[model samples]
Target chain A: MGHHHPGSVSPLRTLTAAVRHHRDRNVGPVKTVKLPRRKLDFFASVLQRFGELHAPVARNGHFVFQRVRRWSEARLEYTRTELPPKKYFLPPRETLFRFTPGKGYVPESEDLDRRIVLLGVHACDIYSLNILDLVFNGKYPDPYYQTRRRNIALIGVDCIPDQRCFCRSMRADTVEQGFDLFFYDIGDYYLTLVGTALGDDMVLAAGELFESVTPDDVAEYKRRSQERHQRFQLDVEIRDLPEIFEMEYGSEIWEELGAKCLSCGSCSMVCPTCYCYDVADETQLGSTAGRRVRTWDSCLFATHAAVAGGENFRHSRASRVKFRFYHKQRGFVAEYGRPSCVGCGRCSAVCPVGIDIIEVINRLRGVEYAETEHAATR
Target chain B: MQATKPTVGIFGLTGCAGDQLVILNCEDELLSLVDVVDIRDFLMAASGGDEFSTLDIAFVEGAVMTRRDEEKLQRIRRRAKALVAIGTCALQGGVPAMADGLDWPSAVRDVYGPEGDGFDALPARALHECVEVDFSLPGCPIEKHEFLGAVADLLNGNPPQLPTYAVCTECKMRECDCLLVDQGRFCHGPLTRAGCRARCPSYAVPCVGCRGPVPDPNLGSAMDVYTSKGWSPEEVVQRLRTFGPLPTPVPAGEAA
Candidate 1:
């Protein structure tokens, strides 16, 4: 029930264990591999030791999670990945069942239900997983997702001091639970760390490959994560959030975004956390055989909020845009007790029209409310 | 199928029938559902009845905005074996929930001049404003698969579970490049629950969080993420309430 992780683990020790864990299963409790200034070969070692290895790799001028067979394939120092590591658990399109109408739901299929070990997950993404676990594991429990989740070996990496990160502000800088193992890419050594029983087991098997990390290293990792928060040089104060919302209930900013937004949903599609989806049942013409599938959806599209009677509740792009903004910040806070945004900045990075959430927050905070209010008075 | 057959009744009050439509969209499976249970009363479907039979489940859609609707929902609650609040209207009041902080009379006046005397007025709130509900399925229209899952589980002698994870979970699962990383589009996926599998993201759009918030979503972090991008607190708040709700804090250590 509890994540129960001891403090943070050293990145160097974590890598050492990863390589040792797979190379020789019988190796003395290989749970981590502290890469102490090892070149790309260390990464290759992990790949060779384990059947496969996953890490962030630069592709088409963007970073993405890919299979790293050799160390050269790994891009340890990068800006950001196109998609977060969460795909390893609950994929975009997964089959919940195969069915026939008269017989009812068949409830079994595997597309994204394969065993995968995810690596290089950032803290913001790690927190995103916790959210996913809550959803898929809650109430009835999604067996498909659970099976994949149970099979995964999460390996997290610290946000490099670059990449314009704001994890500190969003608290994505650190996660108390979710990852099985974590890695902090220190200059000389990649601190291979442990976060769970399985992770501990992997580390125990690594033998001398992993040693007890020094306290200075842990403090340095925390320091780097914290210091990097300032490097982004962009932020919303969060103090005036409620008050800003009060007046922003009817702002012109929403219409502005709507006018330019094509409603393509590319932003949501690429984000590390947007999860709206639609479900439909399909079958061949003459047969009763059919299966219900859930596909992703976006509130930005007019049809997203449309109902049976042809009435669109959040009809206007402004309203729809505003609704999304509120849900992550104010709406979710009131309903579930926390703001839903992880501050990954994926939305800001992927918009075709360049609608920045940070800018919206600033406008709402009266970055110019006073000037606008005065002009209206005049 | 009548051996201890589950008698189910469905009712809608005010707000968009999006939730009802989601159920209706269950088309192919609808017939199967009918075969498994005796649908006692469903106002939107051809299967409603006035026999006033005992009910095992009452799927309530829309917010209880009117007095008559309130009474009807209360009666249904009394008669049904279980009560589920479907859609944001029933759960958090949907778009109508937008009226929560405002005065109804003024709102009516704003939309209609003093001559708009045809409008009826009453105290309003989410479904909780009128009756007790056992479960709530958020989103303007509750996700159909989730609805199906809950219904199927209920029929199988189990309760349905709703996802409390933020929308970010599904967004990442889509393997979509984080839109905010390369562009400046703001999204609400991190704060919104993961019940809906981030359909908007797949279509290359940012999430507007129609399904609402996950339990214990981190507003501080969301704001920090934005602010780090030079967004002010007001801007973050604006984004949080894009759906008409001011992001609130989660209960202590509660799992989303």
Candidate 2:
């Protein structure tokens, strides 16, 4: 229902429109190309020239984004990675600067500009990256994140909807921008969308590898898109979700969820968009020299709100859980005209306990039967 | 340099001296450590010490399991400027205190026969139960880096900062897949204190909560989570008791 605007455009719709405008204004008209499915393996070698090629690979019966020497090592059809491509930009831990008492502070700039080509990114992930760009590219831009973003190239690929996926409900199933190149598998070929001049250059470099799309190919694309859309078993109505979240601020459901929450922060770490970090000055054992390090932080942690005076703003676990939801679904919408969550289902899948976003939202809306039924079968 | 350095002492009570061993295991840092601090008392590492002298900092490991242990802890607390309880035994009653609620006299009799009656033993309890503990560095065996960090902080005249968050924070940072969610493993990482850097989980092993409980843990809900995976409540409690005494379960709907 949220996907279909009946009378007037919503704030998120306006944001999406603005995103489209921004993309078109910067890249001119969208150029479509085709690459034979068999040629993809050979194209991986060509991609290496641009940067260190990283793609999803199997690890311990799960998928992880790792550097691959050969295309055979990459698992393009992976449902999700243990950690998102955001790690390549924000990193789990990074040194911001090194300081000495008398010598002053020296900025850490090592490997800030390492070129990386992230292949097989999902649409929701690319959309999440765009959201990250909004946060990091503000007035006081983070030089670290910005530099990494500039150096890394994204090549998104279409994904098959899993039981956990709810990206369609979040309006992130298809991305209009934020990726240099996007590939959609269609039988024997990949319908590629060149999103930028850099992407166009890649196509140019590939030369004979790419071909023009045909009318039959366009019809096939429409058919596959419909099939993909219908395959999404999980859906959450985002219409007036921010308002619902505001009304349910004192809902007892938070207590129940918080009681069940382990607060391990696995969901936040695996998330494509969660970007909160904590900074600390880690001094050497015997020297005055220390490096100011930044590490990933989660609102769910007990110490997230702890201050110098030993007063915790969100001391209660229930309040911390509520804070995470309110920020992603309510506060973020107020500021960015869109929700921060892309519904990538990483939080749901990675949670040790069954604290699913879809189930939680459905429960809040008082339509819990569908998700409950699906969960029972799962 | 030794005269200019701060005086420190390391003492053990009754539990296994694993925590002190972790300090000695700091092979690389130990040489530099002696140069920076005046380690006046360390029975395991040195021959003699002036027990009457005041210390700038005192690191006490193990729990108060005997009347003598309690008396010794009180003496250490009185002479030290600041006392830090090291390891789970000194913070929470670790594996040693798991027998606290059991029939200790009969249990000891079974282990040592009639000779056990001669052995005088009080209920095993953490050092804080008998004496004031200024700080605590909790782990089954205190982590080597954590001990080194505490010493480093003491050398700079700063209070040692320890992780207040749970083991899950470090586990996630390491990007280890959720063993509990994915494989139905009963990991206590969510409730356990951090600072071991998630050593077990990184190797595809579940945490046994050797670091003790984090602040405001949801105990009842954690039980429910484990029970749902076919583990009985008693079994869950049994697994938890391997490291430390079980805390009272915080019920659902209660703010934790």
Chain A TM-score for each of the predictions: 0.80, 0.90
Runs in model 1 lying further than 4 Å from the true structure:
A1-33, A39-52, A111-113, A161-164, A215-226, A240-243, A368-378, B1-256
- Among these predictions, the greatest DockQ belongs to 2
Q: How many residue pairs clash per model?
A: 127, 0
| Two-chain DockQ for each candidate model | 0.05, 0.54
Task: Evaluate all candidate structures by whole-model CA lDDT and list the values in order.
Answer: 0.63, 0.82
Clashes of 2: 0
lDDT of 1 by residue, A111-196 (tens): 43344556678888888777665555554355555555665667677764343354555656677667767777656777776677
- Alpha-carbon lDDT of model 2: 0.82
Models, CA RMSD each: 16.0, 6.6
> What are the clashing pairs of model 2?
none
Instruction: Give me candidate 1's TM-score against the actual structure.
Output: 0.53
Off by over 4 Å in 2: A1-30, A371-378, B250-256
CAPRI verdict (incorrect, acceptable, medium, high) for model 2: medium
